[model samples]
Target: MVNHALQVSAALADMQIFALEGSRPFGEAVVRHLGLALSAHEERGFEDGEHKARPLTGVRGRDVFVIHSLYGDATHSGNDKLCRLLFFIGALKDAAAGRVTAVVPYLAYARKDRKTQPRDPVTTRYVAALFEAVGSDAVVTMDVHNLAAFQNAFRCPTENLEANKLFVAHFAPALQKEDVVVVSPDAGGIKRAESFRQRLSHAIGKPVGAAFAEKHRSLGVVSGEMLVGEVDGRIALIIDDLISSGGTIARTARACRQRGAKKVIAAATHGLFMADAETVLADAALDGIVVVDTVPPFRLHAGPLKDKLIVLDSTALFAEAMRRMHEGGSVTDLLAGR
Candidate 1:
């Protein structure tokens, strides 16, 4: 067992965590909020695009958490990124370092949870196994697609965090007193939207119901279809887990307007600007957009439409989570976004 460095108190002090970067500072913000010493990193890249990573600080017996956001091309090529991550993890394990936690703000292969399409691999599960094998004592992530993916892959503990608290805080205020309605962009997202609905309803103290839009493989949602619930003339807030292509948001926002929705807003936990997502969202008729900075919100290439996009910090939230975990307290307190 590693010598844990957190100060022992009635409540645990989250400390000694370090943040590394791969063109994003999501982890940097997270560790900074904890007031922990950032781990010293010495990383360089080869002309051929290979990379090397080393920690200059001694971690011999100290609990160490490594934060990285691993996703797709906007993130990196699938296996290439994983290999890079594993290399770093292996380096730590080889050093006889203390327990290592892999903190992924956005788990990459979550959406492909099941082998819905033919000959598809359960990549998320495999990746989880890779983490355990590479010396991860625990795994922390947010809003993964295959919820069961955690259980299947790791021999160690796995925790998934939700962004409901953050969303309700910002979005409820944005749509205040406007007779707002919470909406899910698809049937699959009804659960996420419903969770948001319950929280918003409790906070605003009114009848906040939920609606959903649907599409069958098209980029945009099916047009001219009445929403699953009454959306006519009500301001709509679309809550999604993540935005990769921005198609669903644009489609749902457009459909809401068609159904007499006075205004539309989009919010998500992760802002994954894949392909022309920034462009698509900018052209959509959304009044404003908000996203948690779990996956770094700085890269949105929305031109003038960037002004409409709002980025909120999730670093503080993650930092608190690390604090609670280190203290051996109930992570459940904030699990459902209380």
Candidate 2:
């Protein structure tokens, strides 16, 4: 057995961890990694589609962390999961939890951070307001689409965990050789790709190259088929924040292949795989796809492309973050690469 004393201390002895129905597996993994058990919670769904989640154990004057990834699955839509998490946080506050942290691994609606057209919702800010209204002292999530927007959206303390170290470690062996180029699916993600490239290069002890595709999306239509930077005869590693509908990654992969890229490997922080994504991602030019397990692979399992899918666990990363937060330690090391 692992040493619980080293993982937990008197400073966090009054802390309790809970997980909603949709995030049980992820929460369990985190708890197991931390050498702890999940606190008791009860969730009930009403016939009219209403839901309620309540902590079975006492939380009064105790620090509480709730794990719920706001990603949609076959049973629950993203909005459904978000609403449930919000309500549960509110309930915890009402029950007098000392400090409440919502550990949302895959935060949904993060892409709607900005206003592009008239009367745009700016849903990210609105979601932040919802969390604030529910009395969340802090919000923790991994790889938010817009880091600036995510921070500005929330009034409460927010921690945006980076997956750079995790990705770098996972891809180090394959990227040790030279002639590898990290490509961002679009211009908007050029910085993200560059950061990944820099760390990957450092890991492999070589100077990796960077490239980006020009993509414009308006009203469900995507255009701009331009590839910048050299990709010919090089292994292209496409990096993005997440995948939804799989259009951008597919388009970028095809663009790279057309430019004579030897191989295309795609990596994203979250893999939503929505609406025929499996078919779209099964492109001949793509060699493999890597994603962190912030959200479980509901769509990719038992599919034809399953063989090419690689999932990296985020449990250890999250557990370390939680431990630090509970013990009043700095999280700067976690955000080093990005």
Candidate 3:
């Protein structure tokens, strides 16, 4: 028989939470929701653009969870943040942590799950390899670009949390009496839009409609002005995994309005808002945008788009996931809000 006493001891062992520099605020929110204190760590950058991070406290035999969103900011690129997170995970493993789970709220390079062009790099697989190389026992992220590709790329245990329920809950009241249609900005996000529509429909006890905009990209240019499905005189909720430059969402919103959509709103799990994203999304067709707090919307908050932005707190969701993972409890209930 398995050693019951050993299992109990392991279960009772205190878990430590560490947040990397770029994700400190977000991690702090999650820690607060979990009633835990943030662990101390030291990070220093050399004059040569080299940096290092080390946990101040001993992590030997402890269950360690590192919170870091591998998204770029003013000072660091996405690659830089990824490297720092990877190195920190490796460091914790070297320190003999019994287990290390990487909690990446916004997993960068996730969109590059596959190659569309010849000789294109499969960055998602490569990132998964890097995580495995650092000895991560499990990788946890939210609303990845491609679920199948993400699961297939990682050899270790991977958990992808969904934001569908959260979004549905947020929009339930507003859409309860209105005719709402969930729309995918592009054909590739049809699955995501469908999930959102299903959950929202169930929550509001009404049959939510679905629609999609066809988009084609060539050499960084986007085309395809056609929209599929019924959206005329209905509130359109354009859904996607993330919003970077805001071009796709804007294009879809415009198309929806042109198709007689009464109102156009965009909802995404991550709001990257990169490079004049505010300017791009300021079009009159887009009424507002809702996004989860996976990535801090510093730029958007400081700009004119603040009035049109709705940010939902994801700390509770992440806290619950971490609790279940640490206690060896089933997370199925948390997946699609079962």
RMSD list, candidates in order: 4.1, 2.0, 3.8
lDDT of 1 by residue, 78-129 (tens): 5666677777778887877767777888777777676766797977778777
lDDT agreement of model 2 with the native: 0.90
Question: Candidate 2 lDDT, tens digit per residue, 160-276?
Answer: 888888889999997676589999988889888988998899889988989999998889899989999999999999999998888899999999999999999999999888888
Provide the overall lDDT of each model, using Cα atoms, as 2-decimal numbers.
Answer: 0.75, 0.90, 0.91
Candidate maximizing TM-score: 2
| Span of ten consecutive residues with least summed lDDT in model 2 | 3-12
Q: In model 1, how many backbone clashes occur?
A: 1
Please, what is the TM-score per model? 0.88, 0.96, 0.94
- lDDT tens digits, residues 1-338, model 3? 99965775465457899999989998999888676778999999999999999999999998899999988888899899999999999999999999999999999999999989999999999999999999999999999999999999999999999988788889998887999899998888999999888889988899988999989999999999989999999999999999999999999999999999999999999999998898999999999999999988887756557789999998899988988898988677777464
- The lowest-lDDT stretch of 10 consecutive residues in candidate 3 is 4-13
For every model shown, the clashing-pair count is: 1, 0, 0
TM-score: the better of candidates 2 and 3? 2
Off by over 4 Å in 2: 1-11
- lDDT score at residue 107, model 3, on the 0-100 scale: 96
